[model samples]
Target: MPPPQTTGIYPSDSITEVAQSLPLDPLGAGSADLLAGDVEYRLHLIIQEAKKFMVNGKRGTLMPEDVEYAMDALNVEPILIPPRPLPLPQFQALTIPSSSSHPQQIYHLPDDEIDFATYLKQPLPAGVANSSGVKWKAHWLAVEGVQPAIKENPNPTQRGASRPQPSSTSLRPQARTQLPQELQLYFTRLTTALVPPSPTGPETEPERHRLAALTSLRTDVAVAGILVYVVKWLGESIQKCLMAPTGTIGQLVDAVEALVGNEGVFLEPYVHILLPPLMSIILTVPLGPHPSSSSSNQPSPYDLRLHASQVLGKVAEKYGRSYPGLVPRLISTLSKSLNSPPFPSPLGASNPPSGRYEGSLLALSCLGKQAVKSTVWGKAGENISRIDDLAGRLYTDGGGKKRNPLIRALIKCLSVIINPKPVDITPQANLDDVSEAFGPNLANMLNKKLWTASEILRLRREELEGEGEGGGVDGMEVDQA
Candidate 1:
């Protein structure tokens, strides 16, 4: 008989499309009619039964009302198939054979057959007879293998009697108790021969050699002493130079730059001292009396301020993360400078001199960089906000129409604050806002300067990823470039 053509029943186009798109005889049979009989009919029956199971209480077979009830309950359009009389005898006959084979399978016994406690207590078979007995034997063998051959004594002392006793002497040969008197004299004579002659006498070769060695050691000691003294002196000199109005700002700046430029010096223990004084100098510069004022006639200290600011900026660029305490102070100093007027202008204008404004802006920019550091971000979100607020004010009040150096400085500061690197520190609300405000600007600027900034951002990301792979941040920075 020719098979009935497949028909669509679903309300939506999707289901009908799916059914039609399915190739007829997907199993590649020559005719679609091959899927039309008992096998296909049984599959349809199972699906209908499953749908009935999901809705109506189970009965022997699904009824027409049950299908209608399911369609309404599930909110699906009804799908109908022609019903065939249930082949109860055929199904019963198939089950009879399968049920008869079940009893012979004792190993895969049902739970009803298993008395778990009795099975556990049963004596292990003397030898493997069946699969169950073999499994029991295998388990026993594993347990036996793991059992300790020599039982440990619960009351035993921590150290066993078998432990080796310490010997009176070391295993290595002891150094000779004492040099022979003649050998000691011979060494003394040899040492004397190496010493150079001194002014007092026509010394023997031994005496002269001994003198020479002593003189060389003395000279080296003096040189070392001089170096130590000079370092202390230089440190003091730099400190005085920073504080004194008479001190040469040029010399102090050159010294600071030299000290910082030498990577070794910057990383040294004493570098901390160099920073605060240098930072102080930088801070003091922008706040110095304006060059246009009567005070400007008296060799303005403005140049000193510029040098200080430059040094501070360099320090921040190189070691901002390493020295966290410096960041807040730098920010505070920059803030004060930004708020203060340049020395009173000759024209009585409240505005600072151009140079003072420029220096102050540069200092603020450096502070911005420090504020963006991860350590700072983690704990000083408020500080970051302060930097943003200051920069925003400078940008807004200063006006974007003019291309002043201060504007450029403010822009740089904004960039640093916005696109801060992620650090171990948790960010505060203020910090988050600052980061958000600056982030878009950073993104735009970074996109334009991607070639230059890519490596830096990549390194920062790598550091962040590496931080996760590693346990935590404690020892991580030691290995960072």
Candidate 2:
């Protein structure tokens, strides 16, 4: 009667078909329907239990091994029996290795050895370089033998640096660590060109891939996963760009601008990799000179900075809203790099001095966008203030480098911080024609004010010292003033 109305998980007729198909129809006719009902009920119970295993493991897909593991945990024997392994040929079981023979060896049997020659024959893709980058730094925790690389804090380096290498001396366990081959070659070619800055602009390949990546950044949901690659490419390009001011440095700058300005994609994920290279370029001394100049091939230090400045400026603009730590971190990095009371403000070639930093001053001006002015002033103002005090205290009547680029940059950065945006003035106000004091103009004011302050303080102190030295006037009065 209409297959029992097909209401149950399994219809009676379907069960009868199963029963009839069996060699001996042990459950005859109506009885098959009863058995089917019982089977379906048990199956439902097994699945409900199986799902618990899935959730506990934090996996969406169910695996056979998981079912077996779950069943064992539940105190229920699994239905599927795993096949027995082929018996090992009887050679007497090997005991622990003798200390005298090979003390380095544990008790592994010869049969367990792998066939290296056979595996070695497998071919790898062409132009694939071994990325032997990540190395374990020696660090100790609770005990000597326990490696910090393992157990916790596994990988300290970003993914882009060399792939993780297997440590030979690492405690007991170690984990050993592709761009396409042609793409790899193109990146290499690009870096080489940057280092030398030959006449050839980068081949179309890198530019094409960069465009592709930019496109994918907009459309692809999985772009975040491969951000390491993108960051690496741009960082390396910036690094190379910093090395020399010629060749196709502009392309690298463009790459940085594009990556930073990409609207939809969030670079917050890869900022760690991105920031270091960009900063290094920003502050790295002697950005390569112009290729064409015979007298001094290197571009003017200021010129070198302009490239770095544009990139850093774009980054600050895009990320200033989301990431608060950037400006503060940048100050610390710049502060440490400076030669506190810095080498007396880079004297130019004309002064028979070591270098010039006008370019750096200009670059820093670009970086001080209006977005994070207050944060820069409040959060990092102290460091700049300290440097300012030092720079002033050490100031002399003589001007060597014309200005301290670091101090000048800080001053320009401070002005922007103090006045985050352009000051609105009435048409009749005295300052209407004025623009922001950026670059050399700002540097001139900063250098003058600092020099003036130092000179006045020194003169007053000198006068007091001279009076004390001669007439021995009240020392207490001089000290109080």
Candidate 3:
């Protein structure tokens, strides 16, 4: 029938191709999609933790140590390698001939049975290809922009190579498919290169090619086996990368965005597998503190949260309506984060706010926008209406005077939720309502104090301005707006 239905990030046949390539088929014959989905789920969790590492460091790059900490957060320990004793060694000198007097007649032992003395005494034989003194002959693979005719370089005398080819055993019905030998070879190499033996070591040329292939595939709308194969390969080894403390998730996220951005691809099959991990990335605490440092020294979850929030918001906008529950879960997650205490306290001194406002604000704004339809919001969109009050409550917190990134995000999200653009009106018609829609309460929130509390933004602005007249803002903070 139709290639079996899959709610996983990869198709069943893609998983089957990978499984069949294995010696023992640990996932068995028909379990490819299930196994693939499970792999993605684990990877999803790893990515969630990876963002924490990014957030904790206050940097854009995901360091190896941060991945290790992400692994720790997931309770996935690294596979410790036990040291093995070196085998007792013995040395022997290899004395190769520096310059043979008879360079053309290099040393050779008699192959055909003859006394060594008699063979040496005999004249060098003619009409035999195996003569030890055979002289070198130069043959160019190509000349004058055209291949020189040689034994191997000549056009095939037959339809293909002269070798007797074995019959093929297909992964699917003969009636259904017949992939070329080159493509089969490519598929094997693609899967192997994507999922290496260990997710450690410097990235090499082959891995780079595999990523390029993945990027190309992500842009395709067709339900190709190769697309599912790459996604499954990524999903399978995600945990290993985290355990190895590798920074590969950055590339992985890029590939994901490519897939999500492809307007041609129908994502209904994959969204369930995709959404939860993205949500985790947005919500997880930044793994900012180093392993050696005292816990109190950890940085704010600023950078990582911002990056994840943008990605999460994008996914919500694209897929929220496809799965109605997505909005509810996103709202719940953001609510928990925003409502968390500002500081832990017998001593009371801690980070200014207990939350990262930017991330919650993003999740709130994007999910609210995408899930506003009556069908997606449930109760004929009553739930979407309630979000305005929740957003407004953030303003009630402690004069809302500390203008961190979070406050900016919260106010912007509130404005959007409270005043979505009217469908009937054009863009030019909206300028007048901007001030009226934001109202006196919002105006007070955005006044001169917002500028003062926005030291991080202002300082960053100055630094970039100093850099050049056409300077761009740095990091994911630029993405907040």
Candidate 4:
């Protein structure tokens, strides 16, 4: 047999083929064998070096980058490979007829070259803005020993600051009493804007500043740090303004509205804290110092009560579904105010004002139709008797000198509760029927619109009953009668 052939992973035939690819003649069998051994040894050495990189990097697999690093470390020229194409081109083979009646097979990766001019003429792909290329930006990691008020920073209320370790001698963690400097500055600006040194003139600098501050409270997302403190301040301010001997509660009402309307700050958790101040404003007997008995023309802070009621309504509308008991609690508080007797100065409280009753009624109306039926028109009709008693008292108190807002509000409540549909045929309103339904004092003050609507609704209900078609008619149509 021929001299025992060397058995190795890389065959001498592959080395011969590689040499044929270059500008050199085909190697002799012995020369090819020797060259293949050297090539095989070099590959083994490079792989052994690459394996070290993989182990150091704590990787199970040796990546191509590791091989490149190995080549650089060993001062060996690395083989250059082009980036992978979308769908990699398949390897193609070509055959050439040789003179010895045998064919030579050649394999290669084919490239389809394009002219530079043609490449330039073609429309380029649209590029996205700031999508490609490396870029960097600087953002605050911390400022003045506190995280900056930025989207990157967590809310102080939610992800609270880490507490410091207690000393070995003590077991309790020290509580932080002072607020952050940023929060202190913000609170000062807000309070100053809301309560200027002098009264805010109409469309003046102070007015603009006040408006701007309210707008910030309504829209700013950075108020989380001072939110609890701000709410506490608002509660105290509202109570003081309502209890003050003089001045309108407009500013306090506006501030409360802004705080409640803020989408950024969650107020539901603090609803208990908020409710007392709002209820006091809505139901307090005298919002400002009792308008002196001599000054009968003084304006009642009735409008302020209406404003507070509106804010209360908003709170209910926003959070009612989440807290199912909210509406009922509000109705209960308002019912107490509406049913309260007018004359007494209950020990510590001032004489109850007529405007308190008006505010209660409007507040009930604000809670929508279902609330009206529940409170104004009760399931057993007990509230109706109570309202009649109230109407009589209000009429007696006014003594026909001026229209008590309470009576006007009661009439409005009656119209709202009835919610009558329009009638085509004109029918006379029998005051006798109205008087029988709602006591004489209330019936006397019923406007023509309310009388017509109530009579039509009553007539419709009677017609439905006569037709034997009712357990309370729908829309209560009375045209046939």
Candidate 5:
């Protein structure tokens, strides 16, 4: 028995038109119809085979590569195929008149023209590096409702020790084992709450966290166990944020300030660790990349220096008497920064950034009037005189802006030399004496009032000595009479 024939879903006229495109005679309607049916049957067979490959590959969708594999399996010629997922060419339409007196638009891909000379001359583009493989690091997410004592977790507020008095020495060995689980949880949450999730701008949330952290540092007595850890963390954080943006550096400095202000912490033991980072912020040249002069919206690097200097002043004032060497060491450091030659001698070489010099001056002024008097009128005064000369030259060199910060710093230092209440017996001195004492260049920078102040500060010791001698002479005469 013969089976019924299946009809071709594709149009026979389309098949005839395609045949006309070949270098052969036109096809008759019956031949075109037979060819269309055979072509449609072959297409269906290829698709069915492609689906088998797709099913075997565990993909429900039949990809172009599956079709290629299917053609190979069927022992049939496949069309030219590029790699899968490559970019395809754009299609253009062409209009042609058909036998039905209507124009038909056939879509075809256009060829891309290449210039071999340019292509050969150009360097091959760089291929992307393969990404690092997936990685896993083991850390406890939580242990019995308490966070682990590890770097991955926030440091606990109160570390435990076996001894009655919890010292840093005792806390280190038993930090993990001795902490109560409840205290461990509280420490984790407290530290977590101290840091804002996003510390980008001057947002309210970060400010709140910052204030809260500072308050806790100043007022919380129970945090004594973790005092050592907090100091270490603050030092590390300040070092890390040295090259950070404005708000970031300021944030860490505020933390340090709060720690210094914490009366209960007894920070003298850790001052060695804490002081260097603060000094670095104060003395490091170009504390991170500065924004361009046109970018006035952001705070300049000097503001951070000023704030750090204030904190440094507090540290010195609080500990100066106990550690007499502290003030001298600070002065020595600032002197080194000042002693560097102001001008770059070599043509291509450059002087240190003026910001460093300014910071040194500001820090010196913060020490005390005696420190300022020594730097101005004592042997170290030579450096300030040289800086004054440099400032003058810089002003005449056509960029006065370069000298402005240094001049401001010097002015602030001079302003600090005056006593709050002037003594009537103090000798009066004019600008000539001031010029001879502080150099003519620095003298010109000062006003008459500063000159008087400088003189009072300079002659204060002499006046007191003369008074003591005269009083002794009068007492000796009265006893003899």
Candidate 6:
């Protein structure tokens, strides 16, 4: 007769065999040491799983249900099951440092221990001589200690101007008061870079991955630097970008994007300071043709139009709520784009030409979708009406035909804004009007297509729980080999 299936044993003995083969006491260590090692390994695994859950927007404790689903989906036996940890608490609480304390402590190595000149001369990646990483690290070290070389320089005025001067007092109370601003700046830049760009051009997967990593690092540093200087610097940079003429805007936007992408680690610490001001500029920049056209023959303002669209799209994704003033400008821009003249289509006569106007229209639609639930929009109240007008203009009779890709993209954006779902409820005034205008077709599409990480996890958990209750026979099953 076959072994009782109720033993919770599988027909395959492979798992049991591997378990038996693991070192019982190969190092001659006692059970205490072995148990400690096992606990550590289990903790690491738990942390990893928690990270995945957090990425999927699952907040709070790792319930048995979450663990079971994670194990089944990942096709692995978790080292320790949920509820096994006697003091099992929310993973986020453990992983994230408290606001009262520093997330990371700066370690200052004595100047004599490492020669800065020699360190700078070491072999580096090609084309990295001017890399921001090198400069940022040097700056960090110089500022970390009380008696840093920069501080002890003979010319006090020159030294102070070249680098961030340390606080005169070593009082813990004073340091604590000053840290939050510095940290905010660092996080702002990091978040901006981390936000995935909308599909605008042909970029390979590897390039995308590289950009994400760079942004993540920059955000970390920016978060750390949350100081007045960082905030001011960020604000000034954004102002310059906003004030730039159409002829120069494209180059400026490109420079900001490139810097954020390449030196993410170096910039991470300044994100908080940089983000708010950058967002302000993006929101407030005047839309439409340049104040004064340089010449009728100058590249038709296509490059500026494209760059502006791309920058606004990025800003909307990252900092939509911080600058209420920008929403009207965004709606105005899209309205103009939809009304602009047609250009030659990219995909031949089969599709309508997607000119700078179309691109801007699509970008504006994306921005509105992002801002649907933003606090700024809620406060402004009138912006939603403007968004509705833009939406109506794009899809209604006075607007062009509805079958184009540009139209489809606009519809998708409106759907997202009108029904952001679990993340945010559509405002009643906008919802009633938008729903009536778009009717059941657009509403159904939005409801069917929208899927956030939290929603996905909920579905997976439900499926797994259903299987567990049915003796594992009712659902598809997988086990680690």
lDDT of 6 by residue, 325-375 (tens): 556666665555445544333212333334433454445555654443331
In candidate 2, residue 210 scores what lDDT?
Answer: 49
Q: Which pairs of residues collide in candidate 4?
A: none
Model 4 spans > 4 angstroms off: 1-178, 245-247, 292-299, 340-343, 346-355, 379-382, 395-402, 415-428, 451-481
Per residue, candidate 4 scores C-alpha lDDT tens digits across 62-147 of 88877987775554677775565557668899998898877899989898899977875665455533467533446887654345
lDDT agreement of model 2 with the native: 0.48
Better of 1 and 5 by lDDT: 5
RMSD per model, one decimal: 35.2, 21.6, 28.0, 30.8, 32.1, 25.8
Candidate 5 regions exceeding 4 Å error are 1-203, 290-298, 342-351, 379-383, 393-403, 421-481
Candidate 5 vs. true structure, TM-score: 0.50
The model with the greater lDDT, 2 or 6, is 2
The CA-based lDDT of model 6 is what?
Answer: 0.42
Q: Write the per-residue lDDT of candidate 2 for residues 72-183, one digit (tens) a residue.
A: 4333567685555656554544556565875443344355676877655555444443445433344455243222444443432321343221112111111111244444
lDDT of each: 0.44, 0.48, 0.48, 0.67, 0.66, 0.42
- Return the TM-score for each candidate structure: 0.28, 0.37, 0.36, 0.52, 0.50, 0.26
Ranking by lDDT: 4, 5, 3, 2, 1, 6
Better of 3 and 4 by lDDT: 4
Model 3 regions more than 4 Å off: 1-214, 221-223, 226-229, 232-248, 263-266, 288-303, 342-358, 369-403, 415-481
What candidate 2 gets wrong by more than 4 Å, as runs, is 1-197, 200-227, 247-250, 264-266, 289-299, 343-481
**Tens digit of lDDT per residue, candidate 5, span 229-301?**
5666667666765545555567667778887888877788778778898888887765643332334443577
- Candidate 2's displacement at residue 411, Å, is 6.8
Instruction: Select the stronger candidate by TM-score from 1 and 6.
Output: 1
What TM-score should be assigned to candidate 4? 0.52
Residue 432 of model 3, lDDT score: 23
